[model samples]
Target: MASGNVSSVTEFILLGLTEQPELQLPLFFIFLGVYVITMLGNLGLLILIGLNPHLHTPMYFFLFNLSFVDLCYSSAITPRMLISFVKENVISYGECMTQLYFFCFFVIDECYLLTAMAIDRYVAICKPLLYRVTMSNQMCFMLIMGTYMMGSSGAIAHTVCMLRLTFCDGNIIDHFMCDGPPLFQLSCTSTNVNKVVVFTIVGINVLVSSVTIFISYTSIISTILQISSTKGRSKAFSTCSFHIIAVSLFFGSAAFMYLKPSSTGSVNQDKVSTVFYTIMGPMMNPFIYSLRNKDVHVALHKALKKRMFF
Candidate 1:
């Protein structure tokens, strides 16, 4: 591939999740349902938290932002993904970059936001006396803002680096979405800088967030164990249980997808891993939080009953 050819390339074909004709329609329907659930569940949770005065606490405030991030995260990839299943999956270079940018933004935002939520839980459980003072409204707002800023900065770094690489090779992207690893594989120019930048930024982001969550939960669990009553321990564990489940799913899938050596992993494997976080994670988060959470269940029931009475 010549430099001129690379410079002239304006679009790329997405190979999508699979090449089998028989699987496309089935996968399409499956992801379509996932997208719909993700949207409705996250949006409903957002509205519920906003309208219910009882939920106006630091915990629910973090949850509200989580719902918002899930909504955007799923939207960024799923809609384009659905189109690929039914039609041609050609994406212009610019559109692909845009998709990658937003995808990175929301995914990173969710990472740090989950960390912040864990810290909130830590304060609530481990330092109950200081919870209110530590996680004040202004403080919560700053935490949320910081997560978004971190996400944006990482996204910009990745996109800007990607824009520098030339793509003269075959324009076929092996995966469904414009992901960094797959995109790097297609670059005609040296992707050493892009790879290093991605690894560094992602490493710092995931490491900081994961370590924070781990430390926070360690303190939280220790504090829970100190509670004398079985009921007290169960209640405290229950509060963080849903968060633990969500964080595991989000971070576990993400780490497997991004942190692994790209050469050692097959594209098919990558697709499956990506599906877990990108499609399934968002779809399941609202249910994970709501079904396991007694307060959310109570608030939902109350809201429904109020609506029925009206």
Candidate 2:
């Protein structure tokens, strides 16, 4: 029954964040601005990383990919969401699934990419002598490949499970996007197995990535403590502090959206959480990295100067 299942509902109406008549226009403009900034920020970062020879290290390599993922991640959800703020927000089944798959793919990619960055930091600080050996160009390429592999596998599994279920519960999604939980709730068929598998995979992605980051930071802190110069310690901590902030913001929203019990949070709260991770996360990341990183700032200044002269 699961394998042969076909959707009875061909489209879904997204209820959006607020049903109030007055709030719709304001919200649409706000998210449109967000989407615009997200595009500029990520694109600018990508250009900065690509053009600068000094930034061609393992850390910037990860940041480059991170910016790219954030670009795709926001693009996958924000435009459709902005549309919902202004109109009836109808999405066909195929479009919904496509959005969901890309959303899941980029999100999972970010999770493991952050984990890989943490490992890079760990090696950079804890084993400075072996940093080059440990995170070589080939090694970095492989880690990035592994991140995408995980992302593809995770998204495929979730989308496949959703594909096997038929939706029949009035076709109104109470959230702004085509997320897994709302779709699961809309399914008329038994979703016991789907829920179990989906939740299990979510747990694995969040837990494994977070735990790896924690352990890496723990070792990094320990290493930083042993450094004799306070200046050196503070410099090391500053680099890590920004990454920590970005990780916290992203994972904090993710936890609220996915890990909590369904009975505890309102649909509106879920909408807000989804907005943060999907829109705000991407928009804020470029600022977080570029503002905090001296290397990025210097590269941007140089790029600006060259363009100014040319």
Candidate 3:
């Protein structure tokens, strides 16, 4: 029906999570609360890390960046996603592209950062005597730089590939965001290259990161078992468990979202996975780490005491 393609397209309409009127309001409030907590939790961790001298180790350094990434990751998508809940989610081409770029950026960034943290944990657990040397200031800086670089490259790749597509059909994105699958579905042009690039890049990332995590955790478990005392082994397991949970949640949802068969009757399932990684993942990270970490608890109490005294 429409002859003009993405070139002539000025805007796109985002069909929110569902069309049901009854579900819309409830979903809005739920995600609103989630976003609020995401902000507070992540921002609080960032500030706490900055203030607490005790948390200035390689472990906390990774966490500081993790918090920062989660904050940005949540911010990049949540605000725009929230708009879909209340009103017409009409996003300009530029805005949509921008959102897509940053969304890809943050997600990819989190992937590598989590891998880096796993390595950090590996060094801490498996090679504690050399932890300082292995995860030095310079090394941490480099790892972080590489993490962001990958994010930038992945985002650029996806966005550039997407830009090449010609959208002549209804410019309506079925999901809340400008995700790859829905956008590819709307293209009048062939998306073979896009598919190859998508799977190649995402698969490489997931494979490498997940393999690294698996190896690190396996070694960590072995090392913990070698501990002589029950308390020592228990403590080691306790410390690593939080990171394991975060990794499983993030990577599991991400795999479900990206690696699934792109067939009919699967849009809702994809959206659910997307929402889990994009919405719930970031929100859960800060809580997962802080709630279990004694250092964060001590730091919070000390900060509160200082505030009370002042």
**Model 3 stretches with alpha carbons more than 4 Å out:** 1-7
Query: RMSDs, each prediction?
Result: 1.6, 2.5, 1.6
Q: Could you tell which candidate, 2 or 3, scores higher by TM-score?
A: 3
- Tell me the spans in candidate 2 whose CA falls farther than 4 Å from its real position: 1-7
Model 1, span 15-49: residue lDDT tens:
89898999999999998998999999999999999
Clashes of each: 0, 0, 0
lDDT of prediction 3: 0.90
Error of model 1, residue 307, in angstroms: 2.3
Q: Give me the candidate number with maximum lDDT.
A: 2
**Candidate 2 lDDT, tens digit per residue, 1-310?**
1223453888889888889989999988988998999999999999999999999999999999999999999989988888888889999999999988999999999999989999999999999999999999999999999999999999999899889998866789988889998898899988888878777988999999999999999999999999999999999998898899889988999988888986798888888888888889999999988896889989988988998999
Clashing pairs in 1: none
User: How do the residues 1-310 of candidate 3 rate in per-residue lDDT, one tens digit apiece?
Assistant: 3343344566899998887888888999999999999999999999999998989998899899999999998898888788888999999878988989999999999999999999998999899999899899999999999999999999999999999887777689998998888989888899999999888889999999999999999999999999999999988998889899989999998988787667643888888889988989889999899886899999999999999999
RMSD of 3: 1.6
TM-score attained by model 1: 0.97
- RMSD (Cα, Å) of model 1: 1.6
lDDT of candidate model 1 versus the reference: 0.90
Alpha carbon lDDT of each predicted model: 0.90, 0.91, 0.90
